[model samples]
Every structure is written in C-alpha cells, then in structure tokens.
Target: METRPRGRDGTGVTNTDAGPGLVEPVPGYRTRVVDEGARDGPAVVLLHGTPLDLRAWDPLVPALRATRRVVRFDARGHGVAEDVPVPDVGRLAADVVAVLDHLGVADAHVVGHSWGGEIAQRVAVEHPGRVARLSLVCTRASPFPPFGELAASLRGGTVDLEALLGRWFTPAERAEPAGAAATVRAWLRDADRERWAEALDMIATFDGLADLAAVAAPADVVVAELDAVATPAHMAEIARTLPDAACHVLPGARHLAPLQHADAIARVLLA
Candidate 1:
C-alpha cells in the first residue's frame, strides 16, 4: 500500500490505487471494491460504518495485508457508491456477497465496525458459508438507540456536525495526535447528505439479533470500554447470544475503536 496519509476523498480511490475500481453487481448502486495483499492468500473483507467510507480501515489494513488478502469497499450511500435509495440490512448484506462473488472469492474472514458490524452480522447469518470468521467491532445486534436520536436531532435541525462527532467520540480521543479528529470530520462532511441521512434512518430501525442462531462462523465481538452508542453491556449481550462468539473490550476507546485501537483490533482479526 502507498503511504499517502491514509485519508480518502470519497472517490473510492485510495493511496494505493490511481482509479476507482467499481463493480455493479446490482443495478443503481456501483460498489467500489479494492483488493490488497498476496495473490494467493486467505481473503479478509473490511466493512465501514455510516457517515464514513472504507478509509476508516486505513489503520488496520496494512497489518491485515501482511497475512491475508485485505479487501475494502465503499458501501451504498457512502464514498463512491452511487446515491441510490437506501437499502435495508438484507440488501446491504446481499451487496457484500455480490462483492465477494464478483471477486470470485468463495469465502473470507469478515470484519465490520459500527453500522458495518451490523451488516457483517447479516452476512454471516444470511450467507453462512461465505464467511470463514467474523469480527464485529463496536457494534450491536439490536437496534441502536443513538442512531434514532441522531436522526431525530438532525431532522429537527438542532445538531452541529462537529458536536455530533464529539458525542460519538470522547473529547480526549479527539485531542489525541492533534489531527485525529479531522479525518473523520472531513469524511462525514463529504458524504452525500440525502443518502447519508437515509442510511442512518435505515440503521436506526435495524435488528440482527433474530438471526444470531444461524451464524456458524467463529466470531469475535470487540467493544470499546468508553463506547456510548454500542455500550459494553450491549456488546456483552450480543456475544452471549452468539453460540461461538468471544468478546474483547479495549480500554479507553470510544465508538471508533477500530481506528482508535487499530492494533488491538488487528490482533483480534489476525487471531
């Protein structure tokens, strides 16, 4: 991977690639897919959350590429994915399988963060054979309360973007490395407003707990100790519900634990 400061401008092209490699498995939405690592290595797919693109995985991608073929993509309504009608969890899950099929990948290790984590759960449950292992980071199995509130607040026109991010991440975390907060802030700002809102609306009403029993992959549920959206208790419940799931709580992290604690998350994904 090229070293270009690790931030994408919503074009679906990262530092390593010169052009967007888009695939349209289904009409209307063109998904941006990227592949890295060895030509003949175990495949691993990384999924990003709402309001951000695949660049959210920049911190963990290099480490994962060391031993696995790391794939990252921009989900519909985010990054380079065309602005189409918001898709339900089922369609989102289908998109993942389509991306894998487009790459001719029979199976892969799946990793997701926040909203992406919920989609990852759907992929493991809905397409059990396609996922070798699952890693859910800072996600919940049931509907997320914070998203509902955020949608309502945004609709009411009473929230500021920066303030909203502050609520998602702690003040201390935003202060870390001086410019850590800028990357995420810019990502959210560049997203298509209509699509971003619709995606959040869909996520606010989603629930994946009903399908937990069908997930056959060995799973790791990682949560941040300071996460307010997907609380530690909620993640614990998710872990307990999964027949083959283990939970890891990283200290001093927030909702963006996958990026904030990338090393810890990489360890979990690599394990």
Candidate 2:
C-alpha cells in the first residue's frame, strides 16, 4: 500500500500544480474543482463552508496528498461557482455525488467543515455507496442559527460584514490586514450579497440531522475547542446521532480549524 507522501523536510508534500480541472457535475452548473495529490491513492473530497471557496482547504491538502487523492471545489454561488445556485440543500448534496461521478470515483472519504458537513451527511444517506467515510469539522447535524442573532442583520438591511467576520476571528485577527481571518473577510466582502444571504437562508431551514441514523458509514466528528460559531455542545450531538462515529476536539482552535490547525486536522483525516 502507498504510504503518506512526505515533503523533503519530512512534513507533507508540496502541491505545485495550478489547478481547477473543471468538471460540469450538473449541466449549466459549473463550479471550480481542483484535483491534487497522488493519482492512484484513495480519493478524499474536501468541501468548504459558507462565504469561502475551495481555497479554504489549501492549508489542509498538503498533509493528505502524499497518500491520498485530494479533491476540493467551490460550492454553488461561492468562489468561482456561477451566480446561479442550486435551489436548496438537497440540490447541494446532489452536486457532491455529481463531482465524484465526474471523477469516476466509486467512493471516497468525504470531509466537510461547517455548512459543508451538512452536505456530506446528506450524501452519506442519499448516496451511501459513494461515501467510504465521513468527517465533519466544526459542524452539526441539527439546525442551528450559525450566525446566532446576527442572522437577522443579514436580512433586509445593510450587512454588518465586520460584525459577521468577528464571530469567526479574534478581535486581534480581525484587525490584522492579512492571515486566515483576513482571507475569509475578503471572501465575504467580495461575495454577491444576494447569494450570501440566500446561502444563509438555505442553511437556516435545512439540515441532515433528521437523517443521521440512516448513515451507514463510520463518521469522524471534529469540533474546534474555541469555536463559538459552531459550539462544541451543538457539534457534539452529531457524533451522538450517527450510529457509528468518533468525536475529536482540535484544541486551541476556533471555527477555522482547517487553517489554524491544518496539520492536526490532516492527521485526523488520514487517521
């Protein structure tokens, strides 16, 4: 079997490819899809959460490429995905299966963070054979206002983008002009206001919580110790709901654990 690929310094492999090997998973629904890592290794699909794109996974992919086929994409209406979006969460779930089918991957380890996890869970139920393992990071199976009371601020009035960003980063991180927090801040600023609000509305009323019991694949439920957005208590319920699941905590991490604790998450993904 292939062992995990290592960088020259014994860390992780360097991804040198400039990629977005496009695949039209659904007709008229083109999104940016990037394929990386070992060609023959088992596939691993990484899905990003709201207001972010596939680039959110960049920090985490290096750690897996040595021994796994890593695939990531911008979800509908985010990143390079067209302004038009799938109608609802169920359609979002269908896109995941479509991506795998485009790759000719029979099954894969589907890993999602936040809203992405909702999509992962749906696929595990609706397309069980296509998901070998499920990993949910900083996410929940049930419906919860991801933005808390701030969600109302997104509706009808001017969005306090800064306030929305504060929920994901420290006061200090928000002040900085660069770094993970700033990167996300930019994504939100550039996001189409209508689509961003729509994305929020979609998650508000839809979730995979009701169907967790039917998911047959083993699951890895991970939460950020310091994440107020997706609190551990809320995320913990995902593991409890799934028939087979193990929960893990990324210590000292906030909601962006994929960026803050990429190496550790990489270990969990490969484990």
Candidate 3:
C-alpha cells in the first residue's frame, strides 16, 4: 500500500497527516520513503533520531532539494518500518545501504540526526564507499549518558513522551513546537515498545570514538548550543577526531535542532 505523508509548507511547520510516496523494497524492509529533488543531482539520505520518523525532515526537505536529491525514510522499528531486531551498528548501516541500493544511488551525502547520527558514523567508517559526505547533527562520540535511566523507565513498558520531549526541545519549542510535538507523539504512539527499547539500547552502548578517524568522507558536525545530550563541546571533540570534519553550533537550539532549526541545518548541509 502507498501513502503520502502530509508534506510541510516552506516554513518548517509539520502537518499531522501522512502524504504520498511510500515504497516497499523488493528485497528490503518496508519503510516510509520520501524522495525529492532533482534525480540527476547528488543523492542525499536524511536519517532521523529515535522515536521520530522520516516526517521530521518535512521542514528541511524543500531547502535540501534545491541542490540535491534528498531521500528520507523511517529507520527500521520506527514509523511505518517493520519492528525488526535492533542489531549492531554495522547491520543498521547495511539496512541503509539496502535502501540506497533499492533507490539506485551509488553514493550519497548521508545526513543523520541524534541516534541516526550514530548510525551514520558507523556507516561512514564501515561502508565508506557508499557515503560521499557525512553530516552528523546534534551527535556525540560516546554512548548517550541518559540511556540507562531511559532504559530503566521503559522497563515498565511506558514512554513518558512529555519528559522525553522536554529534553529534546528548548523551552520555547516545548511551549510551542509548531506541530512537531504532536507529530512526534503520534509517531511514538504507533511505535512498538520493544523495538524502541532495542533501538535505545543500541544507542546507549554505541561508542565510535576509536574508529571515527577512519571515516574517509568529508564530515560536518552540527550541534545545538542548548542541547544537553550531544552538547556543543562533545560535537567539537568529535570534529577534532575526524580527519576531515568541521563543527557548527546553532545558538539557543536544543538536541532536536534539525526540527527546531531546519533552515539553519539546511544551510549547513547545503554549504
């Protein structure tokens, strides 16, 4: 079945409905696929963080499409994708490769936010040939510190979305997330608890500090000054380790900068 996730307008506001462009890969898992931009332009894949689906990129897609073919999808176990086991980062990267192969993209600029950033890091190092440019947004070089507490809380099989959202957005955004909050809540409500927990576990234990320098692709490290998890300092450290990487921090933004400051993110990615 094909569906169209409500496409967002130019100002980065998210609409609370699914729009067109869903595809089921012949030999891959089912995930919501939103392909935009010129087919002949350079391919770029946008990966979202935990709990949030591909729609998180609705606001940024237009800007990205101006210069490249932007491909965004729901990672497995989130959004419309199947609730498969959350294997190691290598396997997760392979899944991304499968998506790219299905789309006939030989290589792409891989942009990942938060947990997805961790996956992108692994992909750049493990599957260098498939990644042309690596952009890590609001990401860190070590395990997410809050994972232990998050895992323990999820043991009861309930997600305190309010609390989770609190950490992701700034005070202004929390007060008025401009429809993003509603969209994320809907996504989490539809998500499987076990699969989400598994993804969290994978993020909690992920540490790519040692192999970061091995990433051959030119990299861009973006961070939000107000982000508690992937702090600016942490992102700077990551930039220092990568052989070809630069860091940019958005003032007053939080962990979910991609959604909060879509234009700024697009500027960095486009630059």
Candidate 4:
C-alpha cells in the first residue's frame, strides 16, 4: 500500500499502482477498494459521485482514519475499476456491497456525495443489515425533474463543463476557474460517460422517500448552502423522511462541500 500527495486541486490525483484490499471479480466487472483502519475500530465507507472516484474522499480520509477504519473505492467505470456492461443504482449498490463483503465488513457507516447519495440510500434500503449509519451530502432522494433529458444533453457532449461546475460552486470558488477546470478535467479523464449516463438514469427513476422510514440506523444530511446542483430543499426533504436523522447546512459552501469544507465535514462525521 502506497500513499502520495495528489496536489491541491481537490482532484485527489494519484498514480499508485497498488490496488486497494482484494479485488473481487463480479459477473460483468471488477471492483477496486482501499480498506485501511484498525480491525477493532468502527467501519466507515466513502462513496464518490459521477465524474469523480474514490480519490474525492482524500480530503476526509486522514481525519476519518483517526477513529474509524476508512474504506474508499472507485465505483464501476470510474477510476481504475473496470467498466461493466450495465451500470445502474442497484448495480452500483451491489458493487459497494461486494466491496464490503470482500473486506469482511458486515456493517458500516456509509458516506456518499452527489450521485453516490442515491447509491447509499439503496444500500441502506436493499441491504439493511449492512448499513449502520448514513451520511448524505449534496444529493437528492430522487432524480431531478427531467433528469433523463438533462442526461441526454450531457451525453451529447455539448454541455459546458465550466458552466456546469459554476452552478455547483460558490462565487469565490468559481473565480478560480483554472483550479475548477483542472478538477473537472481530472474527473472527465477518469470517468466513463456511458456509465455516468446509466447511473444518472437510475437516479432519475429512484424514489427513496418511502424507504427512508424503514431505515433502522442514524443518518446525517449535509447540505451546502450555496449548492445549485442539489438544492437545500432536496436535502431537507431527505432529512424529513429518515427515522433518525439530522441536518447540517455548510454556510457559503457549494456542491463539493466535502472537498471545500473537509475539516468541518470531518468534525461532523467524527462527532
């Protein structure tokens, strides 16, 4: 296992050839994961969203490693993971479960951002026994209105990455377009658009509001005050449905709060 600094672009870029833990070959793809922490400590899993991989969690890993065994992984078709034939929320959840099983973790606290939040919800609902807690950040319970159309536009390869990212960040962050562009480029380089499209489609059809009531674990909803992608209203609704849940709105933050406000997020998760 090797660790290296990935610069300061919030991209978590690294070229470590060493794969995380054990790679399990699923029917259509293989999953790569990093499992590191004290064996007796509580287990925590970090899931990334579209256009990003496990490295997105780099900002939070160091802090989380102090108290819990931290596990981060690249979703199928992202990062070094193999691209599977079919990509959907259910499949994505299954991939997560597979990683957990591989690591011999029966239960864990799961943290997910953006599209990953949708996968986290599915995992808690479909594999209730495996999830002890959940942290949803900058994500929604269901797909945004007309997400299919939006995805189609994205797939057409005509969308402006800068403009899209601008909507996700605050004005101050947007002012540094070069940094934002670098981050976006890193994601695009590692991401598979077809897989991204499939994941987005799954989110479009997902409805976890009803399932949240059945979750038997605690949940935390972190919303960026200035998030334009996943609005505060969407997070509020998610918090309302959970049986035991709390909300924390990060002031002046944007969609990538976990990266921009990593220390605050660490405090909340560790608390």
Best by lDDT: 1
Give the 10-residue window scoring lowest on summed lDDT in candidate 4: 1-10
Question: Model 2 lDDT vs. the true structure?
Answer: 0.78
Q: Report the lDDT tens digits of candidate 3 across residue range 1-271.
A: 0022443553222232234545566345666677777778999999888777787787888887777888887787777674655677787788788888878899999999988999899889889999999999987669875786676667686658778877765455557634666566566666677777777887788899889988889999998998888888888999999999988989888877876699999999989
Q: Name every residue pair that clashes in candidate 3.
A: 4-18, 4-19, 4-20, 5-18, 5-19, 5-20, 6-18, 6-19
Evaluated at residue 242, the lDDT of candidate 2 is: 89
- 2 or 4, which is superior by lDDT? 2
RMSD of 1: 3.3
**Tens digit of lDDT per residue, candidate 1, span 19-68?**
45667877777766778786488999998988787778878888878778
Residue clash pairs of candidate 2: 5-66
The worst-scoring run of ten residues by lDDT in candidate 2 lies at: 1-10
Which candidate leads the pack in TM-score? 1
Number of backbone collisions per candidate: 0, 1, 8, 0
Pairs that collide in candidate 1 are none
TM-score order of candidates, top first? 1, 2, 3, 4
The TM-score between candidate 3 and the true structure equals 0.87
* Candidate models: Cα lDDT each: 0.80, 0.78, 0.78, 0.76
| Model 4 lDDT per residue over 64-143, tens place | 88679888877876666636543667877888888888778899999899888889988998898999899998988865
Per-residue lDDT value at 190 in model 1: 67
RMSD of each: 3.3, 6.4, 4.7, 4.2
